[model samples]
Target: MISRVTQQTVQKSTLANLQLNLSRMSDLQGRLSGGKLITKPSDDPGGTASALQLRASQRAAEQVARNVDNGIGWLGTVDSALQTSLDSLRRARDLTVQGANGSMSAQARDAIAVEIEGIRSAMLSEANTSFLGRSVFAGTSNTGVAFAPDYTHQGAPGSSVERRISSDATVRVDVDGSAVYGQGPWDPVTATGSVFGLLDQIAADLRAGLPISDHIAHLDTRRDSMLGELGAVGSRYGRLETVQQGVQKTIMDLKGQVSAIEDIDLAETMVELQSQEVAYQAALGATARVLQPSLLDFLR
Candidate 1:
């Protein structure tokens, strides 16, 4: 038996092949214009999933980088305040030694006391230092100032403000105010309890022309405490800088991963697009010649 081939069969097959070629051309054009290998999940399911995962990781890393920056800001403010406090204390020590001189008359002693009072006021200002409207040394306290006018510590002990810089890393941004400034008012039973109170005592003795040589020892002790805090602040600053560098590197790595998964290579895409275009044109010309009506076919 001989099978008869119909003209309708040839026409249907030709149209289907042409439609497939057109579809491929359209897809290549879209990829070229969009500059992405995977515009939709159907384009490349495995690549799409990988790109999505990489993007999520990138976003998370970027957020951690932001946390590192915020932590750095808080620590920087703390470092500056501690430095200013140390300088003020050193000046106070120099003035205290001058007032302790026995040759100084009552008039000169009174002047020294007044100057000490001024230094105390300045130190009080430093104690109450605020950064971005919040007290940096206040240990998460919502109080407007870290210390009150009378030098009472408003921040709680062992409390700290912190930020997460990575999955395994956290940084403390706030310091303990009581540790830096003490509990305020002096207790007669225990000497050198509060820096402010110690200064007050020194100033009072100077006003009465009393020997302040003994007070110099207390001043030196308080200076040592301030220096210790300055050291702690400096340590925190160095840690933040190190963490920042690590966070930046993590962000950049995540970005590169995302680009490799989701983004297209322009040169490769251009070459592929041109090849697809030529193939589609060839398909169209072949289909035209195959479907064209001949003199014998028209008579049939």
Candidate 2:
């Protein structure tokens, strides 16, 4: 069909083309300046969703990383305390053996008793070891110390401190103080299963000039308990170390994914921006030539 081509229609068409070109240039400039492919969600809906999901995951991983660091600190303190306690028990054993000797004089026995008292103090100190003011052996209890002066356990029976290493896994950072150090008098019925109770028994025997071969056996049993806990702590520490590596690697991978999805490729954007600028300028020149000048142009 034949149609009339009016001047106003031509002018409107030219203005629309110029506006479209200017909008394109503006978008490219925004991307270049912001250095992001998706400044607003409208830019790319699917990519924005993916980027948001990846960022949430990254934050979770970062929190797990913090938990790992705290867990390592707690476990390291526990392991070292257990080792030191074991050494103290060994020394106590040697002293017990010396005290059990038939030829040792009364004065010598008394002196050995004094030394055994010192070992007991040292072991108690180790049992109460802490990480950032919280007892490592306290099993989630906020009692501030694992064992009281009377050798009674202060930690909760089964409750423990734990740290999350991943979305699916958590590791216990605190140990069972009652199991490792003995509750009250250790074996309450015997009044002498706890390390402190046993040490007390040894000291009494030494002062009374009584044979203490049994004390040495008791020390061995307590030492074995310390060794078992130490082994367990070591295993957990190794696990945390491995998990930390995985978490760190996962965080790095998540960052790369997000960057790919959201970050602009500067080189590509620069080239596109230059092209858009050229197109916009050409559109402006073309529009100026096609449209007839108004009365304002005549007055000017």
Best by lDDT: 2
lDDT, candidate 2, 63-169, per-residue tens: 99999999999999998888888888888888888889979999999999999899888888888999999999988788999998888889987789989887788
List model 1 lDDT by residue over 144-244, tens digit each. Answer: 88888777788876788988877787888888877777767776557746688878888898887788787778778877877887887778778878877
Q: Kindly report which residue stretches of model 1 are placed more than 4 angstroms away from their true locations once superposed.
A: 1-4, 294-297
Pick out the ten consecutive residues of candidate 1 with the lowest summed lDDT.
185-194
**Position 132, candidate 2: lDDT:** 97
TM per candidate comes to: 0.91, 0.90
lDDT of each: 0.81, 0.87
* Model 2 error, position 207 (Å): 2.1
Worst 10-residue lDDT window for candidate 2 reads 183-192
